[model samples]
Target chain A: EAGVVQSPRYKIIEKKQPVAFWCNPISGHNTLYWYLQNLGQGPELLIRYENEEAVDDSQLPKDRFSAERLKGVDSTLKIQPAELGDSAVYLCASSRTVYNEQFFGPGTRLTVL
Target chain B: SQQGEEDPQALSIQEGENATMNCSYKTSINNLQWYRQNSGRGLVHLILIRSNEREKHSGRLRVTLDTSKKSSSLLITASRAADTASYFCATDSGATNKLIFGTGTLLAVQP
Candidate 1:
């Protein structure tokens, strides 16, 4: 089976611009997650979805960051008025269940100048 | 805030040698998992050990969890150059079951 897939493996945007990342989870997976990773650091959870409901998104920056999984299979994370500090890798992952092993996508490397 | 912290930010080893990395977390956890990420790539799950379990092995990887000490260690035996990557430990804690990752340890294996 194919693993989780993410679009636009790399993206470059200027500050104050808008940027979006897309993700397609593995077949039959019921949970999806979005994470932000900075240089020399591990990934931090931004949002998590169980089916079409965002079960955990307390860490997401509501002022600028938003994510949605309309059909429960694909998800999109958007950052509006991007800032210089927003430059980092945006990763998406999927799992069979909430407590199961997660499969990750090759992440979109976003650079905000 | 990261709940786990990995010791030795970086390590270098030669092929056929063994590598061990440690992780310490601050909260009570249901399970702890280890993952490997190649340079510029996504993470790949390595092993998972439950709080009730002590040690588990998969192929060349051995993971041990000490819930009492709130720490865990990963051992890769007879390492290969292909094992050159960053290793992370994530704790599954809280009611959300969200994984809180550690700062990761970069390992370089020389062939």
Candidate 2:
């Protein structure tokens, strides 16, 4: 089976611009997650969706970051007015359930100048 | 905030040698997992050990979990150059099942 897929493997934008990243989860997976990984640091969870409902998003920066999984199979994470500090790798992962092993996508590397 | 911290920010080893990495985390966890990420790539799950489990092995990878100490260790025997990557330890804690990842250890295996 194919693994999770993400679009625009790399993106570059100027500060204050809007940027969006898209993800497609593995087939039959019910849980999807978005994470942010900075240089020399591990990934940090930004949001999680169980089916179409976002079960955990406490770590997400609501003021500038928003995410949605309308069909429960695909998800999109958007950052409005991106800042210089917003430059990092955005990873998407999916699993059959919350307790199952997660499969990750290649991730989108965003650079904000 | 990151919950886990890995020992040795970086390591260099020769092929056929053994590589070990340690991870220490705060708070209780249901399970701990190890993942490997190649340069500019996504993470790949390496192994997982439950809180109650002491040791588990998969091929050349061995993982040990000590809940009492809130720590875990990963051992890769007969390491190969292909093993050169960044390794991260993540803890599954609370009802949310959120994985709190460590800072990660970058391992370079010389061919």
**Candidate with best DockQ:** 2
Tell me the whole-model lDDT of each prediction, alpha carbons only.
0.95, 0.95
Q: Kindly list the per-residue Cα lDDT of model 2 for residues B1-111, writing each as its tens digit.
A: 898999989999999999999999999999999999996567999999998899999999999999989999999999999999999999998567999999999999999
* Per-residue lDDT value at A30 in model 2: 99
Candidate 2 structure quality by residue, lDDT tens digits, A10-64: 9999999999999999999999999999999999999999999999999999999
The regions of model 1 sitting more than 4 angstroms off are none
Model 1: per-residue lDDT, tens digit, A1-113? 99999999999999999999999999999999999999989999999999999999999999999999999899999999899999999999999999779999999999999
Question: Number of backbone collisions per candidate, in order?
Answer: 0, 0
For model 2 the local lDDT of residue A91 reads: 96
Model 1: colliding residue pairs:
none
TM-score for all models, in order of appearance: 0.98, 0.98
Worst 10-residue lDDT window for candidate 2 chain B reads: B39-48
